[model samples]
Target chain A: MRICIMGGCGHFHTALKPDIELAGVCLTGEETPGFSFLINRFGKVPVFPSYEEMLKECMPDLVVIDGLFGHHADMAVCALERGIHVYCEKPMAINEEQYKRLKNAYKASNAQIAAMLTSRYEPCFYTLYKRVRERTIGNIKLINAQKSYIFGERPQFYAHPEQYGNTFMWVGIHSVDLILWLTNSSIVDSHYFPSGKNSFGFEGLDESAVAILKLQNGVLATVTVDFLRDEDADTHGDDRIRVVGDKGILEVKDERLYLFKDGEEQELELSDAPDIFLDFIENLDDKGKRLADDEAAFLSTEAVVNITGV
Target chain B: MRICIMGGCGHFHTALKPDIELAGVCLTGEETPGFSFLINRFGKVPVFPSYEEMLKECMPDLVVIDGLFGHHADMAVCALERGIHVYCEKPMAINEEQYKRLKNAYKASNAQIAAMLTSRYEPCFYTLYKRVRERTIGNIKLINAQKSYIFGERPQFYAHPEQYGNTFMWVGIHSVDLILWLTNSSIVDSHYFPSGKNSFGFEGLDESAVAILKLQNGVLATVTVDFLRDEDADTHGDDRIRVVGDKGILEVKDERLYLFKDGEEQELELSDAPDIFLDFIENLDDKGKRLADDEAAFLSTEAVVNITGV
Candidate 1:
């Protein structure tokens, strides 16, 4: 299982390097600096200057894309067209057109494509998902998903909406993915409210965004994302989801899953979460079920892009 | 002030009888049963057969309307027309036409009116409101207000949507009131989703509803109300409100207020909440500020009714 890395600036892809190594997947080549140092500081593997060169020389079985948001679709499409399994960072693409191109390329190949939607792999959320699927909360009627992050230092690309994507597409898509996944529903309608007043002078950037989504299953959901968390707060981000169902309510907040059912509140004991990178690699052999495959990525990315108008 | 009571079925007015009495207001006459029992449980006050009869004979300075939802507007209008201050149960009217008539009648009189929007008087909510007013959370960007209640026994009137208001207008209005009051904004645009699956066979009654409101202040808010709580639950209702601002987040859950600001979480010490009934009496004498006054009640009811299309 030879894997080549391209554009390793994204934190998600960078974080997956160690896990991929631990899974015994071979890192054939790299196209980004410092990534090679991370794989092997002794320089046993050659680091290529570009993805095309790496594909031509290394002929890796898999390609991991961790580039600017705007470039992900092109990179994924290229890899898929070459019959290489691709693990792309979320969102899978910047817009529906790019997503369509990638989807077309994937249809032409036998490789498996996955996106880094890690929320489903978190222990608390995984527990909540299982409870929901088991009908612990009965039929879900409404969902309120929130994502709040500290406005930390950003790369120059973030200042350009064309490269970084809008706040909802970049950050809110996680909640969108969760809504679709947990509810087993598709978006029927959506509206977006974006604000830039508190962007701290980041031009063309929305500091906060609220997306109201109506799902086909007759469920109403709202996803609110903001980069306004205090940098020194107890957590880097405040991620929470509340699911209201006919029988009861379920909420995941501060890394704990709480279920209110039958007039009693109880916290579920969550098992250790499966590693997304490892699971993606393992599913390559069996073609078995994966949490966030290409289809999930496409749906979430499309819905978010449509809502945010990005 | 001499006060008369009409249709004492609503628990709000029943609960306030003692407070009105302590405020030295005389109960000149009554129009409904059980109300006289609540006020004296004896034959201390004369019980009239109807509101008009009580009004004609007593000529009371104030009228407390604890009638069915459909009758609130007419009762308020009747008292207001006679220059009698009125305290009516919530959902001041079941529909827009009734609300409009009440508003017009209120405009044509000097009498002050109030509604049973008791959420603003809860100790925890009072603290949360004060903090928001103090800008403790910065400018409000998004609000998620939730009301979940146990599916308790209901009267026959609840089976008719024409009599009792829809779920959003009746239960979700408290959240709407809070949104308008806390954000200091009026709703500019709104949408509602109503479902009746869990209404316990109550025809034409919605057991759950979700309302998405866009406020004039550019704030986005969602209010979800459901009567699906377990009857034996620790609390009869699960009421929660989450306010997201640029600098921090404020949440009131389980009768406690939590603030997340500057990267830290803390529980706020709340002051004792003033009694709504007593405050209304005091404000009548002083012409001072009162929470959930006629204007607040009118705005909230109108917004909910408009959103629910009831």
Candidate 2:
């Protein structure tokens, strides 16, 4: 089963590299960051100049897309058209039309698909996920989460939501995926409130926003997503989430799991988390049951691109 | 100067006990829990059998309304009509009509008033408040705060929204006060999303809810308020807040102030927090300058009472 890579946009495809080398890999038409890493190590831009050419020759079992944000859906749909599995960076689609097309192709083909929602596989989140499933905190009543990133040097594509999409879809989707994965709840209703003031001079960039989600099982959650972190911030991203339950509370921050139980703040040992990319490879045939809902990634992206801001 | 006590529903009025004993307190019409405390101590259900009688005789310099949650407004209004100061337990008014009357009376009088918004005076929050004023976390971007309470035995009034009010206003009011007080920003637009489901057993009880506040200075905040805490939980209430700004981040919880700056989490030495009741007593002449916005409290309660639920 051949695995193929496409596009040079982001480093998400790097997750597939070690596995790609170990199992033998094929390069599709685009010159991606992964391509250079492979070329500098193995010598040569390693041929196949296009997606159609790669598909005709390689007939790869999977396609990993790390392309322009807007191009992910069409690329995934192209793979799905031939029943190839896709391990694409979020989101698989940027618009309702694009999502619908990808959904159609995915349903019609016998293919496995995944959005790169890797946060849930982090050791801290994984430990929390196990504890949540174990009812460590009891019935979840509310959740408050944050994902903040610095506005350090963006690729020119970011200036256009049509190409890069807004930070709500680009960055916020990770939390959207993890919260759903951990809570095992569906979003009955969600609203994205964008702060339109601070865009750092990019007229189309949505620098800050919040997502309010009402889960079907009576859980209320608010996700604060922003690219407003100051350059002086020590880290490029700040991720934190606190889950409050009827029994107690649990928090995941700075690679640590904190349990606030019986008024005690205990930092619990983290659970070992599986590499998402390796897990995807190992469970290729299990289909949708294995991955954080790729469709959620698509749906959220579609919802935010045409955001009804408040 | 005299401090007269009114009815007692909750134990918050206990904060005034020492001062009341030292400063010579008076008791007005109606039997309150405080009346029992004073009577049990002084060997009598002391004096006045009516508010008017107490006003005429005691001419109390201030009134502390710790009556039925619904009667707070009328109680405050009565004192305001006579230019007497009031330190009322929250929702100075429950409905718009009540708030309008309270506002009218307040505007026409020289009375100093404060809501029992005591959480902002906690050492952790007070410390964060100082740093915010000092511009420690420069240019606020967003805020996430929580106030969770256990559904311990509630008063008979809990079954009546008309009397007890929803938890959104009753409990969430604390966070509204603190978030606004710390940010030093006015609420530009606000919304209350009540998860009108988990009401334990009382149909009228708002067991869980979230308040989304858009501040005037581009601060986005969400307040999660609930009465879904399990009885076995350690504390009666779990209060927490995280303020993120362009410069750094700060959190207040568990009686400690945590600052996340330059990727380092530091538990900072807390600043001295003035006793809220003591501060109010000392600064009665300062009017609205000292207390967390009493109007924000009233406005929030008023807005939520007539909530347009989603």
Candidate 3:
């Protein structure tokens, strides 16, 4: 499958490009750090400084819009309108207004669009979701998750409101999406309070925020996002979820999933993030069980903004 | 220190009475399966059919109200009116109105009363609180806790609303009190929802309820309460908490405190639950930090009723 990569030299492209063959590039050099690396590997295959130029020249089957987070909706809209499938990273947009626009655009285009909430595609997350659905854990009462990373200096684009929007939109958006997909529930109500001052290049945005999400199924979840962790933290960052149910307790951390039911600890090895991503790629056109699509992406982003006012 | 035990004999009293040399008793033979065990040990101290009679007869220096969950405020008011100090078991009253009455009574009498929110008094819980205070955990943003047990048929008294108001009051109360005390902050706002189906016991009383608690200091906490486990589950009646902070994560489960900071898990042995009765007994002069007293107990109990309702 031929694919064009927007924001070609950025973090996602640097990691995902070698895994998936790329047909074209849209690197402005001003947007990302790894432009030289992309040029070295791909031999300058249709390099363009803008999305419109890339589309007109390459016209690839799929467009991977892994650019600055806040731009996903607009880029995805362009790709979908041109009858190309789109794989976009999360926080489809910063707020509900932008998310609604993306939703409408996706509907109007009637093309395949997926969000890279890859965590939902993981084996452990999917297993836990199935368990909750089957009532294997009984009635869930609470869900608590944390996604913390050590922030040093972010890319210049992250400092722009037009690019990253807010810390909640840029980083917190992952947890918001995963919780809903994992639980198969929608957030009924939510409240967020920003904590820890941010010294980043942005203004009026929190470096750390805590959101209380109340799911429609009566599950209450707390998601904490912090861009301030000590450097040299463990690989893959740190992610944890503690789900309390009437009959059991489930905790996932690192790559191990632990379920405490019948008063015993049962440990299982979880598939890593890459495995989850590969599954999505393989099942792209199955049409029976699609991965997280624009609608899921839109709702999750709307939930995040509703809670954090990004 | 002189003490009077009301509605004596349960696991709570059995564990505590020997620790705090019981000076008097006002048993009603209505408490628990352990009542006969207490009768075997204590050997007929004093018996009263009603709480009012017990208050009038055992006018001791300290009142240890270990009755049913719903009777706390009435018993507290009786002790306070007669200028007696109180250290009562949790869900200090059925509702906020009753808690207000007890608070006013204690204020008028100038008595030192403390709620037996013994989890706060537990050495592990206290250590966790102190660690957070000492910045060992840094700025806390997320707190998740659970307490569940294999539910059994309650005594006939439970069918009477006059005895046990709700399951959230009877058992879930502990989690509410602990979240407030451990965070050292008042709950600013909260949203609680029923778990779709009652797993613990009956209607009108939540067998299990989920609460998204917002602390005054911007910490987000989610707590769950349930009494629906298998009859033979080997769990320790359920206790766990995961506190995520800027620096690291601290988790406590089954008397083992695990600190995961700086990228490794450190196991620490925790001491047992505090001898609450001993603390209240030793502080009979209205001086020491009493449990379920006038001020603090009211807030804790109010939280319980707010989640469960009277």
Candidate 1's fnat? 0.48
Where does candidate 2 clash, by residue pair? A8-A32, A29-A50
Please report the candidate that would top DockQ against the real structure.
Answer: 1
lDDT of 1 by residue, B99-163 (tens): 99999999999999888888999999988999998889888888888898886866667777777
lDDT of 2 by residue, B95-170 (tens): 7777788888888898877777777677888888888889888888888887877777766677777887677777
Instruction: Quote the lDDT for B164 in model 3.
Output: 65
DockQ of 3: 0.29
Clashing pairs in 3: A150-A229, B113-B293, B114-B290, B114-B291, B114-B292, B114-B293, B115-B291, B115-B292, B115-B293
lDDT of 3 by residue, B33-73 (tens): 76656646856566666667766776677778877666777
Please name the candidate that would achieve the greatest TM-score relative to the true structure.
Answer: 1
Question: Which candidate, 2 or 3, would have the higher DockQ against the true structure?
Answer: 2
Residue A245 alpha-carbon offset, candidate 1, angstroms: 3.3
lDDT of 2 by residue, A5-84 (tens): 66656555445453363222344334443456654463343456567567667777787777778888888888888887
- Write candidate 3's Cα lDDT for A152-244 as tens digits: 645666556676677666677778887787677898877666653444555555667666677887776667666655465676466677677
Q: Candidate 3 overall Cα lDDT vs. reference?
A: 0.68
